[model samples]
Target: MNSHTVRSLAYLTGLIIKSFGISLVIRSRLGTGAWDGFYVGMAGHFGLTVGSWLIILGIFLIFFNSFLIKSKPNFFPIITIFILGCCIDFWLHFLNFEPDGAESQVLIFWVGLLFTAVGISIYVQGQFALTPVDQLMYALSKRFGFSLMISKTIGECFALAFAFLLHGPIGLGTIIFTFLCGPLIQFLIPRIERMLFCR
Candidate 1:
């Protein structure tokens, strides 16, 4: 296969893994990551699935990102968002695993967080389009001279506030995820990029 085909396959693989991570977190039933919390809360308020809300929010973020960057919105990322939304719902339905107790739930939540970190690292290393939420973070960082870490934290805070307002599930897991995921992703990115491209 050509290099492009290989890269595409890798990207898709990463996305599937990412979806599995998301589903695992959801099934843990402790709490969700910031964006997932917002999606779930919006889903509850709108009477739709979380994946549906993901798509809707993804669209809005795409436009918002365009506004921030002062460029024509790139619609390509919507393809990733649509596939990601479908994959999230598919994994959630397919896995059908649940933690039985508080200890088990905590264990599962950490595992899911690790999975999410690794999945993000792999997909980002693929150099394909980012999801709209991530794009927004990047735009903010570039436009305002904030570090990516700061932008991510700010974005998560906004998501947390929106989720809380909408009565989403918030707990220790949410707080942990908000504080740790960005740093973890930053730590992983360079290593993953080298692994992917240094071969």
Candidate 2:
């Protein structure tokens, strides 16, 4: 396969991995990533699949990101939206196993976090389109000269505030994921880039 084919595969694979991780995190009943939590709240309070909210909010971010970077909005991540939304719903429904206790829940949370970071890193390396939320990090980084880590942390904080207002599940796991995700993505992306791109 050519580079494009490889990238498309990686992109799709990463979305699946990320969605699976998201399902596990939600199922753990601990907490979820900030934006995922917001989506959860929206889905619970309003009516729609979590994926549906992800897509809707992501569309809003497209213009938000464009305004930040002072560029024409990129519609590429709309693809990311549809694919990821569908996959997340699929995993959320398909996975029927539940954590039996706090220890199990914590284990699942950590595992899910790991999968999420890895998936985000891998799909980013695909060099197609970053998911809209992830793209927000890039926009902020470009506009503000923040590191990816800082950019991501800031973005999640904004999402967290909205999640709180929306009455999402906010707890230890939410805080942990918020703090860890940025560093993990920072640490993993370079390593993943090397693995995928370095000869």
Candidate 3:
């Protein structure tokens, strides 16, 4: 295989790890960040799997992002989300350990959170398609002439509102994770790149 193909496979492996971590976090019953919670909430209220909702939302965002950026919709990331969605379902199905107590729940949450962060670092650091939600963030920033921070805040607020409406788990974990996740991913990215010898 070509180097690009090898890199793509590695990125996909990272996505599988990330998806597994996401399932663990969701099953912990603590809470995830807004976008994830929104997907989980849809899965619970509607009649689909969490991974299914993830793909649906990702697809919806692809169009929404296209509208915002005034560009043609890129369906390439659908392939990425499809793998992620399947991996999430696979992990959710096979992961049979339920949290025995609050302590165990916390343990699961932290472990999953770390894996999620590291997996994100590994894949996102590579030059490849990212989630449509990420594209939405940039689209919003450009369309409204807002900064990335402001655009992300707007996206988070909208997602949080929708998650609340869906009765998704909105708890301390979500709040703490919102604060912790970005910095953790940022910290891990460079180290992971060095380890992987990626640019």
Winning candidate number (TM-score): 2
Off by over 4 Å in 1: 1-3
Model 3 C-alpha lDDT per residue in residues 68-161, reported as the tens digit of each score: 9899999988988898889988998999777899998888888888888777777765568777866666788799997655665567667878
Give the TM-score comparing model 2 with the true structure, all chains together.
Answer: 0.97
Q: State TM-scores per candidate.
A: 0.94, 0.97, 0.86
Best by lDDT: 2
Residue runs of model 3 more than 4 Å from their true location after superposition = 1-6, 140-154
Error of 1 at 130 (Å): 0.9
lDDT, candidate 1, 87-147, per-residue tens = 9988888878778899999988898888887887777655688889888778999999987
Q: Cα lDDT of model 2 overall?
A: 0.92
Which wins on TM-score, candidate 1 or candidate 2? 2
Indicate whether candidate 1 or candidate 3 has the larger TM-score: 1
Task: Let me know the TM-score candidate 1 reaches against the reference structure.
Answer: 0.94
The list of candidate 2 runs beyond 4 A from truth reads none
lDDT of 1 at 125: 59
Q: Write the per-residue lDDT of candidate 2 for residues 1-199, one digit (tens) a residue.
A: 6778778888988888998888888888899999999999999999999999999999999999999999999999999989999999999889778799999999999999999998998888788888999999999999999999999999999999999999998888999999999999999988987777664
